[model samples]
Target chain A: MKIEDKKRVLREMVLHRRFEERCYQAYIERKIGGFLHLYPGQEACCNGVMEAARPGHDYVITGYRDHVHAIKCGADPKEVMAELYGKETGSSKGRGGSMHIFDVAHRFMGGYALVGGPFPLAAGMAKAIQLKGGDEIAICFLGDAANNQGTFHETMNMAALWKLPVLFVCENNLYGIGTAIDRSTAVVHQHKRVAAYNIPADECDGQDIEVVYEHARKAVDHVRSGKGPYFLELLTYRYRGHSMSDSRGYRSREEEEMWKQRDPIFILRDRLIAAGEMTMADYEALEKETDAYIENEVIRFAEESPEPRVEDLEKYVLAERETQLPWLTGKAA
Target chain B: MAQIMYWEAIQRAHDEEMARDPLVICMGEDIGVAGGTYKATKGLYEKYGPLRVMDTPISENGFTGLAVGASFLGVRPIVEIMSVNFAWLAMDQMFNSAAKVRYMSGGQLAAPCVFRSAGGAAHQLGAQHSARMEKVFMGIAGLRVVTPSNPKQAYGLLKSAVRCDDPVFINEHELMYNMKGEVPDGEYFHPLEGSEIARSGTDVTLFGYNISVHWCLKAAEILDKQYGISAEVVDLYSLSPLDRDGIRKSVSKTHRAVIAEEDEAPVGVGSEVIAIINEECFFELDAAPVRVHSALVPQPYNHTLEKAAIPDHEDVVKAVLKMFGKA
Candidate 1:
């Protein structure tokens, strides 16, 4: 990779870490409600893939731990925060909360909450793009637990059979809400499972941003060439509990510290410093910039955003003017 | 127009839609090579091929979810469950995924899918296969439920259900498969959520749907022949988004009403119809509304018990006569 590319990746990782830290604080302060899954230790998997795919051309969808993914995919920070706050200015207009964030303009399909639910949707979107004669590819992200869902197999089978343009990325964070991958799945290597569908599969070190980017770029290229769907499993970890209310009793504190030694953000920062690509002053200035940006977003979402009105709840339940039936008028006999 | 059975009408609708639109597809167990269990899709596989007419494994949830996903990608899929009793296996995908996707995606996605299956008891098919579960789906939002009483309505409504951009449930009665009725030919699409008044009269109104509509018509004939009373019969084709105006207009002219359904009495679609009429035209009614329905019990396997469980023409006649103080 070039020195400029390394610097950009480092800057993006720093922004993601700071943004996640702000989300954690906001969640604790009651500014953000509902389930908040933090992406503290898995920044490289999100940043690396986002760098490989074209933002407006390639579509992206993922599981609930998606604040960083949305940011890396170029969604406005103010709108994301407003969505977390359940405000009308949010991306989904307060209808989809922390778990579901969609920005159709940027080709970010959504951040689905159900396990493995987005796999088939991503495949469908890829099929649509293929039918429309567009070269756009769909990248779907899921956790280790989602691999056990039936939708995973159903979607993979169809994608491979039809040779759809879809890239499946499994962020194997070692644990699914305290249950280790070994305990949950029969095979520890998650990538090999997709072999039954005859799709190409690979494993990459998610902590190394360059390695992640290289593998993801290659897999994405294969799908865009219409070869078939490709599965890329990234070995990573999470630094926080499953949610804000988890007891964290399933894993020991020593296990947590052992994985913390290979934190993606810290490793990228050290690599940048060693290569003389970035100075200490430059790193500190980036942190300050990110902090100010997040602070402005918090203020904009809290003070300027308005709550969704009571009458607006019934809106968006159906497509506007899509049905010609008269029963929707809510009139009496 | 030639006379056709109810099942043949459903088969014709599927064939015509698949031939008309390339995006329309059908999937179900034993539907491809063996046709459907009831032979409703007999020659579809040979005509449309495997890609459009698929034969799926017995995994209801898996195939149902796949149909939902396909619908999201702009494919109009008509998914057939062998029987409505087996729909419980796919309830998660139907109610949670298919029905909520449009609303949960903030109206960005639409599920243009139809789940068609045979419902109601067929002689001694036992308890498992004897349920008239149309009421269960009618209670759900974002889903349209239609039960056609005759071949003509079946042909029109099935085509409309496939074309509509919503999740529609078409409940077909097993006993009505062999009964023949006149049907229109060529391209036709009936408007959904509307009621059809089968018989016109001025003394009493009979509101019913599906097979019960036939019984209500029979009882109306008996009232005119034996008691010199005229009775009007209304066929409620669509259950959800019901045609309230049709029922109100009929009751206003007749001044007496009787609602009949093929399911149990308490909290059935008949109850809902009666509630709507009472609220809308209470002052126009001369007598309290009566409902004719099956007793609340699991359908028995014995022929005599099964015959006694469901309401027939006699029950409707007795209910009408009692309402007119002639019992």
Candidate 2:
């Protein structure tokens, strides 16, 4: 990879790491309410894959653990933070809250709450792109657990049959809430599951940004070149629990420590330094800058953003005025 | 005026919409080459080509989700679920993603698509195939549920549903495919919500939708001819928004109501109609509102048992006669 590109990737990874750490702190302080899923350990997977995909052209969708993916795909951090705050200024105008963040202009489809829900949506988007006559592809991010959902198989078959431009990216964090991959998934190798449909799939180390980026480039190129749906699996882990409510007694402290030692952000940082592309002071300065941005700018923006009004709660339910709500009008229109 | 079958009306509507808009596309299990199970999409593939009329695998959730996702990017996908019985598999995509995408996204996105399925019992199709899940769909907030009772509405409402900027669940009956009614030539858009008085009367109002509307109309004739009771028939086509004013006006004039539905009792369409009458026209009502619904049991495979399951002309007449103390 180019030195400048490497620095840029490292910078984005640092930003995502610092931003999510602050999000964790804010959640503890009760500033960010509802279910909070931090993306500290899996920053490299998001940054690498999203960086490889074109922002305006390619579409990105994922499950609820999607703070970093939105940011990486050009969604403003302030708007995203405001969304987490349930403010009107948020990306989804407070309607989606933390789980549903969408920026149509940025081509970030959304963060669906249901497992395996985004796959069909992504395939549909890919189909739409094909119908509309475009080489653009849709990238869907699924957790290790979601690979077992019926929608995963259904969507994969449709994407392959119709030759839709979609890349099904599975971040295998080894656990689906409390269930491990071995316990939940019949096929432990998530990428191998897609082989049943004759689609090409690859797996890479999610801890290494360079490796993930390399695999993502080939995968994105294949889909963008109209090679049907591609499945790329990143063997990763999550440092935080499933949500704020999860006690996380399912895994041990030693397992957490082992994964923490292979943190993607630090892995990239050490690689850049060893190659003389970046120094330790440079990494620290970048990290400090990102921390300052989130602590001061992002947090302040979310804090100042106004919550959506009670009156406008019914807005966006329907596109136009086809049917009337009984509560809103006292009678149907 | 041109008389056409229910399937012909639906096919014409698809033809007109697909010709007018290039963005409009259709997809389902047998919609392309096989021309749909009910032939609702007959000749669409040959006319618009395979790209516009897509034949999808037997994956309801998959294709349904794909349609919703495609709608996100401005391609209006008219998805078919073959039968409402199969719609259960795609309910997650329908409710979670398609129905809630617009509201949950805070207007950042909208799924202006249509999902049409041939539903309800016909020819003793048995328990699994006999599905009138309109009550369940009507309960969902973001979806627009419409059931057409005649060819005119099958044409007009579908044209309107295609033009609608929200997700529309069109409940087309399996038995109604061959039924014919008068449809005016040229383009017309019907109202997606509100009830239409199929027949006017002053004594009692008999409300029904889809196949039940025909029963109500026949019962109205029987009441007027056999008995001296003047019965009105109101077609509650739009189940979700439900023409509250139309219903109120009809019930207030008649002062009596008998809601006929093919669906089973308890929290179904008839129960909703009863609730509306109880709330809006309780004072106007002289007799207690009666619900002529199907037997509260799984539809049987036996022909005689299946015939006894859902409400018919006799059930509607008996309910109306009892309401007027004529039985």
Candidate 3:
């Protein structure tokens, strides 16, 4: 990657981290309700793949920890925050909270709440691409624990069978809620499990953007070139508990500190500074700018946005429900 | 008008729609090369080839969810589950993903997919195979559920379902594949949320759908000839919306009602029909609405036991006669 783009990525990683911290604060303040899964420690996983793939062109889907993926795929952070706040102007029009940040126009298909839900859907998008003869590929971002789902195997076999262009990026964050990967998963290495389905697979350090970028580019190339589905596992950790209510009693603070020592943003920033491409002052300025933007623009936009109208509660139940059932909308048949 | 079998009508709909737009694709086990278990998708594989008429493995949940996902990208996929009994495996994809995605995503995406499956009792296929699962699909808020009684409906409803920009689950009966009827020559799109009056009458209204509509029609004939009762048969093709207006209209005119269903009574189609009648047309009824349904037990394997377990035209006739105090 170019130094400018690398510098930009460093800034984005910083922005994503600060943005999520504010979301954490907003959740504590009760501004954001329902389940909120923040993507703090795993920014490089999604950013790396999204950078390698076409952000706004390639179809993207992931599990609930999806704010960063949506943003990377061109979803406005303000609109996303507005959605988190359940505002009318939010990305999902406030109907879907944090778990379902959908920006279809930008090809960010959605952030599904159901674990392992995006597998077949991702392949299905690839099928659509194949049918349309489009150059686009479907990029599915999921957690390592989601690999245990039956859909993981089912979709792998089908995508490989049909030669669908799908890149399954598994961000192995060490735990699925309270359950540690060792306790739940039979085969801890997610990339190895895809061998049964004959999918080309590999794993790398999710904390390092450069490593993630290198592996992600290779995997994306393979899938996009019609070599069938490729599974890329990025071993990582989540600094925060799975949800707001979770207390980090499952793992030791020593382990958390050890993982934090290699924080993705810090690593990228240091690398850029070491290469003489960026300075400490530049990093500080970017951090201060992002904090101000999140507080003033994103949070404020969400806070001031209108609540969805009660009468329009049935807006998205079915796209054509009004025409299909005219009586419901008080239209004459 | 053209005369054709029920399955052929479905295949014709597939052919027409797939030809009309390349986006319309079909996926299911035994659907492509095998031409579908009931031959509903017969000749489609040869016509559309492998890409358009793709065959999937026994992974119902996976493929169904995949089709739902494909529908997200405007690729209209008609997923056949081969048998409705297996739909229980794919309900998460149907209920959680296909039905709720649009609503949960605030209309940013809609799964314009058609899930077709053959359901209901069929020649002692056992309890596992005899699902009568339309009730389950109907209860889901966003998913559209429809069942066609004949070839004409099989043709038009499938066409309309392919065009609908929402997830539609067409619960076809397993026993009705060979049933023949005349369908319109040109394109015909059936209404997805209304009941058709198969046999109009004044004395009583008999509510049924899909395979049961045939039973209801037979009971109607028996009532008119043997008992001098003019019985109306309401083909409830659309189950999700329940066609409350049609139920009210029929009950208001007939003043008496009998709901016939092949499924067990508890929370089945009969239960919903009775509930709708009570809510919409309680005052119009001459007597309490009665339901003639199969015995509340797992469908047995033995022919005699299976025959006794499932409700047929004879049971409907008995219910109508008993309701009129003439049995």
Candidate 4:
């Protein structure tokens, strides 16, 4: 990667880290409600892959640990936070909370609550792109645990058979809630599971941003080139528990500490510093700037955003035919 | 107007819709090469080719979700579940993803697709194959459930379902595939809401849908010829967003009602119809609304036992006669 691209990637990973850290505090403070799944430790996995995606042409869909994915895909931070706060100014107009953030204009399809929901959806979007005569591809991000779902095998078979232009990404965080990957799934290597369908797959160290970018670029090229769906497994870990209320008694503190030492954000920052591109002062400045932005801009905007009224609760239950405002609105910020 | 078989009428709607819009596609098991088990998708694969008329793997959950997903981008996918019994495997996709994606996404997305499946009992298929699951779909919020009685409705309602901006489940009777009727010519679209009075009379009203509509029509003939009872029959085409006012109009005129359904008694269409009558036309009714539904047990495999389980024309007559204290 170029020096300029490296700096941008490092900054985005740091910003995502800072944003998720504050969200953790906000959830504790009872400001952000509902099921909160943080993506603090998996920034490189999203930023690396999403940066390679075509901004308006390519589509992105993921599981619910999705704050960074939406932000990385160009959704406004203010609107995203507002959605988590259940505010009217949110992306989904306060109708979809944390688990469902969607912006069609940006082509960030959604953050599905169900574990394996996005597989078939990604295939569908790819079909639409194929029928429309576009090389635009769909990237569906799922967890290692979701690999056990019947949707995984089913979608992979259809995607391979139909040769849908989709990149099936598995963010292997080693654990599905409390159950470990080896305990839940018979196949530990998720990419190999897709071999039954004859789809090409690759695995990478998600803790390293450069490695993630390199592997993701190759996979994206394969799908965009209409070589069928490519499954890429990004082996990473989460710093926090699965949700806001998780005790995380299943995993040890040592295992958590082990993953945190090689955090993606730290890896990118150290690489830039060692390359004499950025100093310790520059790194501190970036962290301070990101923290200030989250506190003053993102959180302030969400706190100030208005809560949707009860009277309009039924507004988006079905799309309106005339304007299609809220549902089929082509312009999504 | 061409008189065609019920399945042929459905096939014509599929053919016409596929011709009308390039976005319209069909996906199911054996639908492409084998011409569908029920022949509802006959000649479509040859007409539209493989890309448009897709033959999916036996994985109902996967293909159903894929079709629902395709609809998000404005691709009108008409997914056919070979049997409604097989649809049980896809209900998670049907209920959670397809039905609720629009509302759950706060209308930022909509699944404008049709899930066409042939349900209702067909001789000794046993409890598993013979499932009348329209009641299962009717209870769901975002779905439009429609059951067709004859050829015209099977054609018109299906065309309308494809065009509608909501997910629709067209529950066709497996036994009624050979039944023939006249389908009107040139651009016909039936509304996905409201009930049609199949026959008009004054003494009593007989309510039915799908196969049960034929039973009510037959029972009406028997009631008029044998007992001198003027019986009106209402075909409940749209099961959900039910025609409450249309039902009220018929029940108020007749002052009596008999709801005939192939499904069991509890929490079925019959219950909902009776509830509507009690709420809307209580004062107009001369006698309590009677429901002529199948036995509450699973459909038996034996021919004699199976015939006794399902409600026929005689059951409708017996219920009506009992209401009049003449049984």
- TM-score (C-alpha) between model 3 and the true structure: 0.97
Comparing 1 with 2 on DockQ, the higher-scoring candidate is: 2
Give one digit per residue, the lDDT tens place, for model 3 in B1-327.
888999999999899999999899999999989888899889999988999998998999999999988888889999999889899999989998999998878888889899999988888799899868887898997898989999998988888888778889998988899998999897777887789999999999999999889899998998899889999999999988899999999999999899988878888888998898899989998998899888988879899999999889998899889889998
Which stretches in model 2 have alpha-carbon errors above 4 Å?
A322-333
The 10 consecutive residues of candidate 3 chain B with the worst lDDT sum are: B184-193
lDDT tens string, model 2, B1-327? 898999999999899999999989999999989998888899999999988899998999988999999999999889999989999999999999989999888888888889999888999899999978888899998899999999998988888877777899999899999998898797766778788899999999999999999999999999999997888999988998887898899999999999999988888988888888888889999999999988888889999999888779999999887777778
lDDT of 3 by residue, A134-238 (tens): 889999999988988888889999999999999999999999899999999989998999999999999999999889999999999998888889999998989
TM-score on alpha carbons, each prediction: 0.89, 0.97, 0.97, 0.96
Query: What tens digits encode model 4's per-residue C-alpha lDDT throughout A182-209?
Result: 8888889988999999999999999888
Candidate 1 interface RMSD, angstroms, 1 decimal: 4.8
Error of 4 at A210 (Å): 0.5
Q: How well docked is model 4, in DockQ terms?
A: 0.42
Listed in order, the DockQ scores are 0.32, 0.53, 0.54, 0.42
Candidate achieving higher lDDT, 2 or 3? 3
Model 4 misplaced regions, further than 4 Å: A321-333
Which lDDT tens digits does candidate 1 get at residues A1-333? 677877887877887788778878888899888898888889999888777888766888888888777777878878888888888888777777777777767777678777887787677667666655678888899987899988788778877876878999999998888788889999889999999999999999998888998998998889888897999999999889887777789899998898889999778878888878777787899999989877876546654799989887877654554454432331212
Per-candidate count of clashing residue pairs (backbone under 3 Å) = 0, 0, 0, 1
Q: Quote the lDDT for B126 in model 4.
A: 96
Off by over 4 Å in 3: A321-333
